[model samples]
Target: MRKLLGIIFLLYGYPAFAQADTTQYRVAGRKNLPENYGRPYVILISADGFRYDYATKYNAVNLLKLSAGGVASKGMIPSYPSNTFPNHYTLVTGMYPSTHGLVDNSFYDPHRDATYNMGNKAMVNDSSWYGGLPLWGLAEKNGLVSASLFWVASESRVAGIPPTYHYKYHNEFSNDRKVEIVKEWLQLPEAERPHLITLYFPEVDSQGHYYGPDARETEAAVHQVDEAIGKLVAEVSKLGLPDVNFVFVSDHGMLLSDVDHPIPVPELVSNRKFVVINSYSLVRIHALNPEQVRPVYRQLKKERNKDYKVYLTRHFPKRLHFRTNADDRIGDILLVPRAPKVFGSNPPSKRKYPGAHGYDPKKVPEMKATFMAWGPAFKPGKVIGTFENIHVYPLVAKILDLPVTHLIDGRSKVLGKTLKSP
Candidate 1:
C-alpha cells in the first residue's frame, strides 16, 4: 500500500506543472462579444473519470445537493473507447471520436503520415488532426467569446479558432485557485466576458488511475472536486450574474483493472505490415495495406479467447458508432479486451495503474460517466436517463443560442427536454 501511495505521488507531479506553460493564452484584440450579449453564460465543467455512481456512493454532499436542485442523469455514456482525450473532445465537439478523427488517445493519421498522441504537445496543439468544430470554435465564429481553464484540444486552433481566453494544460493550479479564476472571468466587462466557459479537474481521474476506483485516495479526490465546485457556485453567485448555468460532467469512469494477468501482445503484431498502438483498453492495428488485413485478422481471431475480442474494422458493432463513419483513424483491426484486462506485453509502463477505462461503455457500465446541470436555465429537480455525451454539445449551444450550422452526431432532442424551454 505504501508503494502504491508513493507511485501515485510520483506519477502525478504538480511541481512539474510549474515548468509547463502556465500563462493564460489570450487572442490579441479579440475581447469582443456579439451584438446580442444577452446570451446565457454556461460554465461547462468536466471532472475526468468521475463515475456515474460516485456522488451517491461517496456521499459527495455538495454535488448531491447541487444536482438535486437542478438536473442529474442516471449516467452519461461516453463514446466508444471511453478514454480521456477522446471523450472530453467528444463532449464539446458533438461528434464521436471516429467522426471527429480523434480515434483514440493515440492514433495513426495515415494522411498526415504522422501519429497523434495525447502526450505529444505538438500533436495535441496541431489543428490539422482535428475534424469537428468544438463548442468554443462555434461560439467564436459566431461572434461570441469563450474561455477554457483546461479542456481537451482547447489550446488548439481547431476550425481556425481558439477560445478567446484559455490556458495551456497545466496541473500546478489548485482546485480553489481554478474556481477563483473562473469567478474572475465572470466578473469581466460585458464585452470581455466569455459566455461559454469550460473548467476541468484531473485529480479524480489521476487518483483513480493510480489507486483504483474504490480506494480511499479516489474518495478524497472526489470530495476535493466537490468542495471546489461548491466554492465556485458560492463565489459566482455573489456577482448576481443572471442566466448563469453550470453543467458538470466527466469524460469516463474507472474500474479496478486486472493488471495481474494482462493479455499479451500477439507475435504477428510486430510485423512491419501494421502500425500497432496499445492504448490500455484496446490494441489498434493500422495495417499498411488492405491486403495485409485479412491474414493477420484471421490469425488473431483463431487465437482469441475469453481475455479479449478481435474484430475486422467492419465487424465492430454499429451500436458502438465505431467504423460506421471512420476506418482510417480506427485502424484495420481492433483488439478490445474484456474490461479489467488490458493489452500489454513483456514491458510497457514499468508501473501501471490497477484502474483502467477505454472500453466499450455499453458493455462495461463501469465506464459510464457523470452529467449534472444547475442554475436558471435548467428545469429544477429533474432526473433523466442515460444519454451519450455527444448530446451535451447541442445542449450548450441551445442554452447560449449558438447556431450549429453543420450536421453532427449529437441531437439536442435527447437532452433538450431538461431545459426550461420549448
Candidate 2:
C-alpha cells in the first residue's frame, strides 16, 4: 500500500496525497494580492549552453562563488528535444514544449498555417504562436513590474501585456552591455523598478557550437560571461535591495559531436515525400501524405540501431513527458541520435564544427544544464540533486507571491526544498 501511494504521489505531485495543502499551491486559479504586498525581487539569468560541468570546469569564479554561498543543483534536466527556445520557454511557463506551442527553435504551425522561426523577428513577435502565459506576463497581471533582456518570447505580448520593459534581441551585444541594461532597470525608483527581471548571455553557446564543448574558445567564452556576472552582482549589491534573489539557469547544454559519425536520414527513410526537420541530433518527420506514415515508421524502426532511436509520436516514451497533446505540433515520427552522433541528410564535412545538443537529456550528462539560486529566500550552502527545468516557473511565482494562471506540470514541493522557511 505504501509503495502504491508513493507511485501515485510521484505521478500526480503533492495534490494526490490527502494530507497535502491543495489550497495554498493550487495549480489553477485566480490569486489576489494585497495592494501593497511585500515580495522579494528576483532576477533570472540564463547563460545559454553552459553545461553543468562548465560551472566548475571552466573556473567560473562568479558561478562558483554563488554555488558555494547558496543552493546549487547537480544539474537541471531540460525537456525532450532539449533545444534552446523550447527549454527556455519551459523554464518560465512551467509547461512542456507541447503545452507551450514552441515545440522547436523553428517549426511549422499548422493552426496558423505559418512557419515560426527564431531568427524571423515578425514571427517571433507574433503573440498568436505562444500558448502559455510567461513569467513576465504573470508578474505584470499581478501588479508587479517586470523587465526582460532577451529571454525567448519576452518581446511578444501575452494576454495583452508585454514586460514593463524589454529590449529587442541582438546577438552582437556584449555580455557587459546586457548586464548594464539589467542594472539600469534595477536602478529605477521603488515604484517604477521591476520586481522581476530576466537576463540572457549567448557567448558560451556560440563558442561551444563553433569550437566544440571542450575547446579553449568555449572556456574563454565562459570566463568572459563569468566576469560580466561578477560585475552585475557588484552593481546589484550596491543597490542594497532587501531580500533580493538571483536565479541562474541555462536553456540546455551542448554535447561534443563527431563530424565523422553522421547518421544519414535517407538510409532510415526511403520515401522522399516527408518533411524532415533536422536539428543535428534530433529529427522530426512530418508526412505529406497520410499513406506514408506507416511505411515511414516501419523504415525508421528497422533502421534503429546503436546509433539512434526512433518513435512514432503516439508511441513516444512516457518518461519524456512529451506528445501529451493531440495537436502537439510534433512530427509523425521522431528520431533521436545517441550521444556524440547526429542525424543529417548529408554527411558532415570534415571541416564542420563538432558540437551539438537536442538529444535525450537523460542519456547525455554533457547535455545537462545548470541551476543555482542565491538570495534571502533560498537556503544557504545547500546542494540538491538534479531537477527538471519546468519546476523553475513555480519557484519564481512563489517568490513573487503570484498565483499561477494555468495548469502547469511543475510541482512546488520539488523546488520548495531549496527555499528558507517562511
Candidate 3:
C-alpha cells in the first residue's frame, strides 16, 4: 500500500499536469527519405533521477545485462544546478542551461517580464520560453522523422518545430503503453517512420522525491522501470529492425536532504525589492531594480553560512557555466544550499518528503546521472569515464546523420569514441 501510494504521488501528484490531452498527436505529411528503413534507428530513453549507483545497488538485472553487452559509462555528468528540465533540455540541445535559456526549472526572464515554471502548462508549452534545437527538431529539420513519447520542450514547438509524432505531458500514461507506442512508431511505413525517438520515465524520480533514494519504494521503482525497459527492449528486438540502437540516460541523480530546519523564505531582503522563486532545491532571486541588487546581495551574503552559498550572477562558479555567456534569464542572485539542507517554507515546517536533488553533482556525487548504449552502433563491452550530458546531443545527431546548423556547447569528440567507427 505504501509503494502504491508513492506511485500515485509521483504520477498523479500534480493536479495541474493531469490534463485532457492524453492522446497521441501527429504532424501529417511529414516525409523522410525515399528509403527510410535504411536510416539508423536511435531510441533515446531517459529514466529521470536514476542515480548512477541505483542499477547496481538495486540489482536492476535487465539494465545491467543489457549495458554489459554494450558500452556503459562510469557516470554521466549533468550541467550545473542539476535540475530536471534544464539538464534534460541540455541533453537534447547540447547546450548548458544558462546558454540554453532554461537556467533553472523555474526562473525569471527579465526580457519577457515573466517567469517560466515547469508546472505552468502555459509557460511549458510556450515556445518562447525554451531555447536551443532539441534532437527531434534537429531530425525533422534534416528531413528525417522524429517522435517523442515525452520530453522537455517536446510539447512546445522548440526550434520552431515539434517532432513528427508527439504527446503532451501527462502522468497517467503507463510504461507499457509508452513502449507500445514506440513500437508502433517504428512499425510505421518507411517514409512515415521516425528514425529518432525519445521516451521519458518519471517513476524513479518520483519515488526518489517522496521516499529517499535508498528506500524500499525507490528500489521498487527502480526495479519496475528496469522491468519496463527490459520489456521495451525485448518487444523491440522481436521486430528485427536493422541498425537499431538504444541510449539510456538520466536527467540527474537524487539526494537525501534534511526536511526539518529548512531554509526559510528570504526575510533579510524586502520582498518588494526582489522576487524569489524558491523551488526548495535552490532559490533564484530577482531584483526589482538594478540599484537594489547589491544591497540585497550584501544582506544575503552576510547571512550565508554552511547551510547555503549565495552568488551574484557575475560570481557564480565559472565551471557552472551559468554566469558567463548567459541570457538574462539567470537570476540576479543565485542561492545554492548544500546537501541535507534545502530551502524551505516560512515558519520552517518539516517537509513532507526527505528525498531531493538539484545540487551541484560535482559536490554531491550521488547527483551524478547514468549513461549506457547498446546496438549495432555502439562499441561492445566498453566503459568510459564521466562526461557531461551536453555531448549527448551531438552523439544522437551523429547517429541519425543529422546536421547541427547552430553552435552548441556539446562536442562530438567527448562521446565519439563510444560509437563504432564509420
Candidate 4:
C-alpha cells in the first residue's frame, strides 16, 4: 500500500500532497501580478457556439476591428468532440476534457452511479468532481479578487472561497443585463477590482441547437451579442484602466445538424458490442462484455466509419492529447460522424430545427471560432498563427503573476509573445 501511495504521490506532484493548505499559493509582485507594471487587465469573453465566419458573415464590425488590430488565430482548436462543458472547463484548467473528467455536456458518473448533466449546478459545482484549478481560483488564491458571469464551473469553490462576485446559473437573464453587470464590476475601484473577469453569452449556442448553425435566427443572435459586446468595450475604453487586456474567444464553433434525424444507439447496445454512456454529434462508447477488447474495438471502428469514425480511447488523434491518460474517464471507443446527427437511446426524432457541436474540433472549416487580445502589455496589431483554448489559463496566471507549479497542457510562449518583456 505504501509503494502504491508513493507512485500516486509522485504522479500528482509532491507539493500537491500538501493538499491546498492555504489561501495563498504564491504571489509574484507588489500588486501580486506579473512583473510588468503596465500589464493590462484581461477580460476573457466567450461567445458560446459562435462560428469563425460570424465576423464577416454577420458584419460584426467591433469584433472585426479587434481581430484585425490585435492577435487572432486563423482557428482555435478545441478539446476533442468539442462539447461546451468540457471546452469551457479546459479554458480555465489548462487540461483537456478527458483529463478534467468532463467528457461531454452530459454523462453518467459510475462512481455516483447517476446521470451528471452539465447544466445541473448541483452536479458540476462539486469541487470533488473537478480535477484542476480554474483561473479565477488560482487568482483568488494569490490574493487577487476574481469575478465571473455565468461561466460553467465558476460556481465551484476555489481555495475554499467563491468568486469575489458571480451569478448563479440562470437561462432567463437577457444579454443586455449581462453587459450591464459586467460594466458595473469593471467600474469598481482598483483596490476592490477583480483581477480576472469572465463573461459568457449563451444565445448563439442555444439558437444554433434549435436551428442549423447558419440559421437566420442564429445569425441574428450573433449580431445582437456583438452589439452587446460593443457596448461593454465602449464602456471599458472610457474607464481607462492602465494596461487592461481584452481576450475574446469561443468554447467551440457550431455545426449544422439535421432537423429530422438522430442516430440509433440500441443497435450497438443490444448486440453487446458497446455501451452508450452519452452522446452528441460525437458519442462515447464503452466496450461491453469484452471478449477481446482490441478486436471488438477494431470492428466497432470499421462499422462506425461507414457513416461516422471511431477512435479507441487509448488511440485518440495526436493533436488533441485528449486520450493521454487511461484513467481520464474516457470510453473504450469514441464515435464522431462526418455528417450532422446525434445518437441517443431513442430512434431518430424530428423537429423543425437542430444543430450540434460535438463534432471533431478540426472538422467543419467554418467551425473554427475567433480570438482577439488588445491592451498595455500585448503588441497592437500582432498576429499569432495558431492558438489553443488551454493557453488562456497560463496567460491569466502570467498576467496576474500567480505562481503555479504545473506546466499545464499549453505554453506561456503563446501568450508571452504578446507581452512586452520586463
Candidate 5:
C-alpha cells in the first residue's frame, strides 16, 4: 500500500505521506509561490439557447441568485449570423466569424475546396477550418491545465494543443453525469487538475427548438438546468474551492418560426448556378458568376418587405462589423429575415423546429443571450448594461492572465466594469 501510494504521489505531484492533508500540497513547480502567483481559476458554462429573459421568465432561482450575488448583464448581443457554432467560438476567441473563419454553422470554403458543417465530425475535428487560438489552447500553452465538457473546438488541436483533459461531445450524457465529471476533474491532484474549464448544456436549446421558446417544455428545461447549476455550486462549495470563478453564458436566443411565411428562394433567383445556404433566419446566396451578384442582389432587394431584407456583402452595413475581409466565407449576397420569418429552399412543412436563431442581434429581441459571472474576481451586486458577445474572450484572457498574443475584436476595457481589483 505504501509503495502504491508513493507511485501515485510521484505521478500526480501529491505528498504521499500526508494523504489526508491534500490541500497543503502545491503543484510540482508551484511550491513556495506567493499568494498572487497565478490568476484565479475559471469555469465557463454555456447554457445553449438560454435567452436573456429566461431567468426572469422561467424564474430560474439558482440563476437569479447567481446574478444577485455577482455581476449580471441585461443581455449579451451575439455577433452577426447569431448561431450556435459561430457564437460559441466567438465567446472563446473574441473574434467575429469573419475574422475567426467560422462564418456560419456551415459554409463552403473555396480556398480549401471544402465544405464545413457542424454535424460533420471530421470537419469539426479538423483544425484546418478553425482560425485563431481558443481559450483551452491558450491556457495549455501558458502552462495552465484546461478541461472541456463539450465546448466547441475543444476536441480539436487548435494552436497545436488540445485541452489538457476533454471528452468528445455526446448530448446523450445526462446533466448529472456531466456535473460528476467536472467534480472528478476538480478533485484531481493540484498538478493534474485543470485551472480552466468549460461546461456546455444543450437541453434548453433543444427543448426550445422542439416546442418553441415560450412553451412549457422550454420553461421546464430552464428550471432543470438551473437545478443542475445549483448542484454544481453546492459541489464546488463542498470541495472548498472558494477561489474558483464562474461565467455563465449562452450562444444565442430562440425565435418562433413563422411556418406560413417561408421566403421563396427559387422565385428570388432563377439562376440554378447560385448556391443557397439557407439557415432559416439568414440566407447566403453564392453566385457562380461574379457578374450575377448584383442582379441577384437587386432581385432579392425587390422582394424585400417587413419580413426580410437583402444586401450585397460588399455593401453590408458597416455597423454589423461583417464583410470586413475580401475573402470572407460569407456569400456574395446576404438575406436577413425578420423574426418569426425564415429563408429556406423548401416549404415550411419540411422544416423540423418551431424555434430558430441566426438573426441580426440588434434588431431581434429573441436573439440576445445571457451573461453572468460570480467569484472573487467579479464585483458583487453589479448589473451591467448589454454588450456584444465577442467581448467575452478578452475578459476570460484577463482572468487567466494570458498574454494577448493574437488579434481579437473584443476589448477588455469594455467588460472591465464587471471585475473587482484582485
Candidate 6:
C-alpha cells in the first residue's frame, strides 16, 4: 500500500492538499460559482438499495430521463460489502471502505471506546469519527455554501466548519416532507444558495431488509422514492438555476438471504460463542470470553462450510484491502457470505426476510450499482460505461476546477463520451 501511494504521488504530482492553506476549500465542480451567478449546485440523491432492474421496472422516469439525456454510466462499481455508510462515504470522498476508514455499517470506535452504527446520526455524524472530508465541506472551505438533506455525517463540522444549511437525520418524517425541505433549500437565493446538495432515501433499503430484494414491498418502496426524485428534479428545473448538475446514484445492490444458509460457528467449535457485529463489508466476531478464543479460532480455520467463508484477520481477500491491525476499525475475525446468502442481526426463528451485502468485491452484481448525471455543465446523452466509485470525487473536482485532495481515491475521465466537449 505504501509503495502504491508512492507511485500514485509520483504520477499525479502531490496530493491536492500538499499545496494549500486556510482558504475555505472549494470542491472541483464549483469553480463556476460567481458573485453574479447563483452557486453552481450539484444535487446528489442516493436511492438506497435501488436495483437497476427495479429502476426500469418501476418506470423511474426521472432517473431514466437524466440517464438518457445526460452522462450516465451503465452502472457503478461499488466497494465490497455494499452497505450504506461505507458506500455513501465512498461516493463523497471517492475512496474505498479500507482507505476512507469507514469500513462497515457498524464497528467499534476505539478512540471513543464505543460501538458506532451507521443508523445513529450522533455517532456517524461526529466529524472526529470520520477520516475523510465530504464534498460539501470542501465546497464550504473554498467559499461556496453547501447543504445536505439526509447524507450521514453531513452534520459534522469539518475542520471546524459546517455546511451553510443542514438538517439532522429525521427518518420519521414523510417523504413529502423530505422533498419539501430539499425544494426549500434549492429555493434559497444566490448569496444563500447551497453550492452543493445531497439527499438520501432509505425506505427501499429498509424494505429490502425486511422483505427480500425482489419482494413487492421493495418494488413499491422503489416507486415511491422515484416519485420523490421526480418531484425534486421538476422543482429544480423550475428554478432555472444555471450550470447545475444532478448526480443520481445508489450505494449498492442487495442480495437475497435465507435461514438455511447459516454457517453455524458454534457448531464448528464446541463451548465457544462468537460476538457477531454488524458492518458493511465484513462480518466481524469478537471472542467475549478469552477461554473461547482458541476453540473459535481453530473452528474457523478447520471448518469448510459453504454458506459463508471465514478469514483470519491477516488473510482477508486482496480486493477488500481491509487493515486488520489491532487498532484498525475492522474486527478480529471476519466472515463474508457467498452470493445469495446474508448475515442477519438476529437469529432465524424471528428473521422475517433475506437480503444482505458486505460480500466479496468480486461478487459481480453486488459490487455494481448505478451512476447518472444531468445538468447544463455536463454533456448530454453520454455514456461513461462502468466506473469505480472512487473516480466520482476526482471527476467532480475536474469539472469544478477545484484543488484536488489526497483523501480521495478517485480519478477523472471524460464522462461525456457521446457529447462534444464544451
**Which candidate, 2 or 3, would have the higher lDDT against the true structure?**
3
Question: How many clashing residue pairs appear in each of the predictions shown?
Answer: 0, 0, 1, 3, 0, 15
Misplaced by over 4 Å in model 6 are: 1-39, 110-112, 267-281, 286-298, 324-327, 344-349, 414-422
Q: For residue 83, what is the lDDT in candidate 3?
A: 85
Task: Determine which window of 10 residues in candidate 5 has minimal summed lDDT.
Answer: 23-32
Deviation in angstroms for 363 in model 3?
1.2
Model 3, 26-98: lDDT tens digits are 9888989675557899999999999998999999999999999998999898998898889999999999988
Where is model 3 poorest over a 10-residue stretch in terms of lDDT? 9-18
* Comparing 4 and 6 on lDDT, the stronger one: 4
> Model 1 clash pairs?
none
Tell me the spans in candidate 2 whose CA falls farther than 4 Å from its real position: 1-37, 267-272, 304-306, 345-351
> RMSD to the native, candidate 2?
11.8
Please say which candidate is ahead in lDDT: 1 or 2: 1
Q: What stretches of model 3 exceed 4 Å from their correct place?
A: 1-13, 16-19, 324-326, 347-351
Per-residue lDDT for 197 in model 4? 86
TM-score of 5: 0.89
Task: Select the stronger candidate by lDDT from 1 and 4.
Answer: 1
lDDT per residue for candidate 1 within 1-422, as digits (tens), equals 33433543455332342366889989987765557478789999999899999999899999999999999999999999898888999999999988988877888877667777776777788888888999999988888899999998998999899999999887667788899899889999998998999999987888898889999989998999999999999999999988899999999999999887788878787878778888868888988888989988998888757888899878899899887444378888988888788877556667867888988898899999999999899999999999999999999999988889898899989999999865
TM-score of 6: 0.82
TM-score of each: 0.95, 0.88, 0.95, 0.84, 0.89, 0.82
Cα RMSD, each candidate: 2.5, 11.8, 2.1, 10.1, 9.8, 10.6
- Sorted on lDDT, best first, the list reads 1, 3, 5, 2, 4, 6
- Candidate 4, run of 10 with poorest lDDT: 21-30
**Candidate 2, overall lDDT?**
0.79
What lDDT would candidate 6 get against the real structure? 0.66
The Cα RMSD in angstroms, rounded to one decimal, for candidate 4 relative to the true structure is 10.1
